[model samples]
Target: MKFPIAALLLCLAVSGASAEATYGAPPSGLADHLARLKRAYPDVILDYDKTKLTLKSGATIPISDGRRDKSFDELLDEPDIDDMFAFPYPAHAKPAAPAFNADPGRVRVESLFREIYGDCRQGAAALKMRRVPWFGGSVLITTRQGVDKALEAVSRDLEKLPKAMQKYLAPSAGTFNCRAIAGTTRLSTHAYGASIDLNTDFANYWRWSKAGKDRKVTWTNRIPAEIVDVFERHGFIWGGRWYHFDTMHFEYRPELLAR
Candidate 1:
């Protein structure tokens, strides 16, 4: 049977339109995510492939370990690069209690973090430290990827807020301490000198809060949205957003916040 040329032409036009629509769609998926990672740290992430990320130092890190059965704790402890996105960071969203185990920027891959911010164990991170002025004081932060500058930008914006908000920022709990996270052998982001903890007085941590009969730690935040907003705009993510809340904590994680 012979097909009608007019109908054939009409079908062809529709097919072309469909293809164009798909091609023009907003970027998503692994390739786009990888490109964002490269853009987030142009100096460190040289390039990436389907399975690995190549660093400027001539080293490569696997993107995934091919394990999808990891428990929440395992994802935190043995995370690969892909696991870092286990939870999509809800950047700029109104602050609210996150669902259980919804810690977006918490599943860090130690190797990638060490690559971006030098490991502090051998005093390498300290070597890159720059003292940026905070509220009436200074905090030691890393110069890597201009993270010190990011913190400075955050401080400047925070100062613009009403004076009462200053209480939450002044006398920062600390920054740039080469210490492991509580109850874990893994190094905290603080160890990389890329994190800042606001005043401990207003801080609320899951470990410090009482759990209900259901064993769920109640979420609480004393830090104002104004403070979290400034930090996030400058590539810092608030720990208070995590289900395992740490209200005074904010760490620089540009990759997670990239659009």
Candidate 2:
């Protein structure tokens, strides 16, 4: 079964145990997967023809470096351009424990991010950072790709949420940090000033919980679906949807939201 190349419905959800058991596997059709990305960030990515992805800046990146037979550790430790889309991001869905190893939107290629956002550690990413007004104070975020504007819209909408939900949002855990992801050498999207973590008091991290001998992570979340829906509505992807969930995290990934 082939989807229309132009329609390219990129997001597909798997429920029950399938979400965990086979979530890491790549989507069956690569062409459609890449097409969805092309449609999502038209300004940044001009085209993707399976072999390579071309940026508007005239730079070309190989879609697949052809390092096959990757181990699960390899996917987490190092993923190429195509691997980033191995798992589909479940937009507009209620938070659930992701199927085993179903960490979508997490396997980012650093060079790809640095190319667009610039290196935050060297002041490039930070240089593009701007302040956006939030609940009570303004938050620092990148102005690139309309991120700061999107966040502003999100802030305004979040303010309309019930007063009880504000606690999960206020006094944010910090954004625009140029630091490596905890337990990994790779810099996170937050380092690019494109991601934010909500109130830590209501957050849940897989690492915070003790891992079983088999490493079956116990998933938990305090943030509500209403909050997640607002973030998705404004072009942010929630970390709570990933199998290796981070309940308080949300990042600007318009490519995944282009659908």
lDDT of 2 at 58: 87
Cα-based TM-score, every candidate: 0.86, 0.86
- Separately for all candidates shown, the number of backbone clashes (residues 3 or more apart, or on different chains) is 0, 3
Model 2: lDDT of residue 7: 45
**Candidate 2: deviation at residue 15, Å?**
30
Candidate 1's TM-score reads: 0.86
**Model 2 error, position 28 (Å):** 2.5
Candidates' lDDT values, in order?
0.83, 0.81
How would you encode candidate 2's per-residue C-alpha lDDT over 112-215 as one tens digit per residue? 78767778778754448888877787789988878898899898888898999999997889888888999989898889888889999999999998889767
Query: Which parts of model 1 have CA positions greater than 4 angstroms off?
Result: 1-28, 124-127, 212-215
Q: Which residue pairs come into collision in candidate 1?
A: none
On a 0 to 100 scale, what is the lDDT of residue 148 in model 1? 89
lDDT of 1 by residue, 2-31 (tens): 569888999998775544311111123666
